[model samples]
Target chain A: MGQEHILKSHDNELARLTDEIVRMGEIAIEQLREAMVALQRRDATSAESVIARDVDIDELERVVSEDVVQLALHGPMARDLREILAALRIASAIERVGDYAANVAKRSVALGFTPPPPQARGLGPLAEIAIEMLEQVLQAYRDRDADVAAAVRARDAELDALYTALFRELLTYMAEDPRMISSSIHLLFVAKNIERIGDHATNIAENIWYVVHGEAPRQERTKLDRTSGG
Target chain B: MGQEHILKSHDNELARLTDEIVRMGEIAIEQLREAMVALQRRDATSAESVIARDVDIDELERVVSEDVVQLALHGPMARDLREILAALRIASAIERVGDYAANVAKRSVALGFTPPPPQARGLGPLAEIAIEMLEQVLQAYRDRDADVAAAVRARDAELDALYTALFRELLTYMAEDPRMISSSIHLLFVAKNIERIGDHATNIAENIWYVVHGEAPRQERTKLDRTSGG
Candidate 1:
């Protein structure tokens, strides 16, 4: 093959891989949205559907891995090498995001067993922030916008603060009414799952920065979730 | 350099990467052991120590990534490519295992505030099983022993069952005494963290199988943790 042909094919392969990752990210975001809706509506069927669709994201992640191996066979150097590594890491992070979304859906199903507590509404804002972060990070990845990625990384503290507030609120609610303990416990995990989704989004942001700059971000963001310190 | 020299250097690099990963795994295991002790003894000092040392594992993971990039620059084909990919993945899994260990330690510190519950004793067996799985999986990775890796994968069900039992126990304990709610919630997270460590160990086991076989394990293992099902 001519040199131009080789370069063209490599570009095409890279584009395809990038597209696959974006699609995976989109599916993960959709899953999170559906999970939140299910949680709010007490729709076990929709929640179950979200759970079933998680495998699709997992399969896409597997496809991305294979694409990465194919690209690696070309023996990419320096910048290309960094992009490949970032792609692998980002895909894995997105898969975890999908898993966390599925966990939320699973807990939503579990939440269906009892009367929905008023505190269940608190999860909405947390999920909203996480979903927004996931969307922004995916765009940063697609555009290779390090600045936007950094902005997304900085926004995680917002999610953390919201999660912490809901955690304390739920604890208080559970304490006041012992009967709410079982469902509130499930809500607690669901909230934790959403908080972790924010972390995965941050991970994707950091990977994007690494891909663009060939280095890690200069400083780690301050963690605001003080629940573990209590 | 001659072909033989190149091959020898490659072998040496691979050996170095393997050794580094093993050392990282050992540090993570020790962290978990110390974290569990801190929880049992309510030693916030030891727990803080475990949290501080988590950075060492993160540093080792960064080194592993550099080693992987160097190895990839050599343009290894097929089996060597699979090994490089598996090494990157295994190192990431070990890093997460370390993070979970650190999380367990953090919650142990949080648990120190309240009087130790008798139910705290329940976490011991769960941690024991997870620690054993991690040790066996690391051995399997070092030896390239697919059979041992498969065995470790199978053993995760036992850990899951134990986690479920403990989850119910903690909930019951908290429900019985409202005063214990705060500490029990921390223990719940601690238990969840340990359970996640088991999953990471299983992830390592699966990666070892991939390295040996060049494919995922044929059949997905059955998940035994039914807590999400309510």
Candidate 2:
């Protein structure tokens, strides 16, 4: 094959590889959203589905990781190397997100027999925002859009605000009515996991910027500048 | 001064530096422990102390980082470089642990009332385990005992077990008493953060062994054995 043709084919292969990892990310988001919806509606069937289908997500994570390793052994070049490394990191985060969702779903199943509260706060909106954040960052990864990735990074604060509100509201409810404590605590955990998913979204956005540009994009700075062993 | 005298003084400086960092680690762990205890006991004084002393932990983290950076720049031998880097990572983790303690203290200050029953069950033991784990790991760091570090790694499972039991127990309490939702939820988060502190201690143990042995000493394996990146 001509050198240019060979290079073009190699890029395609890496793109396809990244696509698989992105699919895993998509499934993780879906599982999370469904888990939240299941809790909001107290739908056992949907919650069970999330629990049962988690194996597929786990398998995808395994396959994607193996593919990245295989590509690493071949001595990938600059862009190719960045693409695979980012995808590998993204998959691990996605799988962990999935595990968190499954934990939420199991809680949903367990709380079914409890004294149902008169009013349960819906987590659907929070889940929607989390999925949107994950989707946008993954799209940025696919297109190598630094601006879009940066926008995703900035959106993390909004997620944190929602999470804080959810916690406070849940607290108010529990304080007013001790009967709602058990299910409410589980719901709180599910919400916390969803918020952490937003953090993983930020991580992905940061990685996307890193892969597209050689430097870490401007971070919303932590006050502690850890100059360890500087 | 004689060359022998200069050499002895330099060794003393190194010893002093190590001792100073360990003392800093102790401060961070104390802050973390007492922050949780203050929340459990509703002692605002202890909690306030944590907020006031966070800057000192941050300052120490910076100093340790500078020392490590200077050592690295001077082109130390491979073993020395490993030890220096390990120390730097430990300093950074300790600083973050202090941040976690400060966060718990803030929550305690805001609470300003008796915690919900679910919180009492969930957070109290978790705080104890995390504080003790930090103590063990810091000892391993000072003693340079790989076996002790390995033992700390193994102790993580106990913390994980406590976390699981506490979470489930909190869930049961919440279900029985919905009024406890808000405080119970906050306590759950505090527990989760403390559980993560346990994980960070494991990380320190892992780094210590890696520094001493030049390879990560494995105990439990993670599923992500992919070829792409470490």
Q: TM-score: which candidate is best?
A: 1
lDDT per residue for candidate 2 within A93-155, as digits (tens), equals: 788789778767777777666654443555667778888999998888888899999988888
- Candidate 1: where are CA atoms >4 Å away? A2-5
lDDT of 1 by residue, B13-114 (tens): 888888889888999999999999999999999999999999989888987877786677674755776787788889999999899999988998887877
User: How well is each residue in A113-215 modelled by candidate 1, as lDDT tens digits?
Assistant: 6777788888888888999999999999999999999999999999999999999999998899888898899999999999999999999999999988988
> Candidate 2: misplaced stretches above 4 Å?
A1-10, A79-85, A115-118, A219-230, B1-125, B131-157, B164-184, B196-230
DockQ, candidate 1, comes to: 0.64
TM-scores of chain B alone in all candidate structures, in the order given: 0.97, 0.86
| Pairs of residues clashing in candidate 1 | none
**Model 1 chain B weakest lDDT span, ten residues long:** B69-78
TM-score of each: 0.97, 0.63
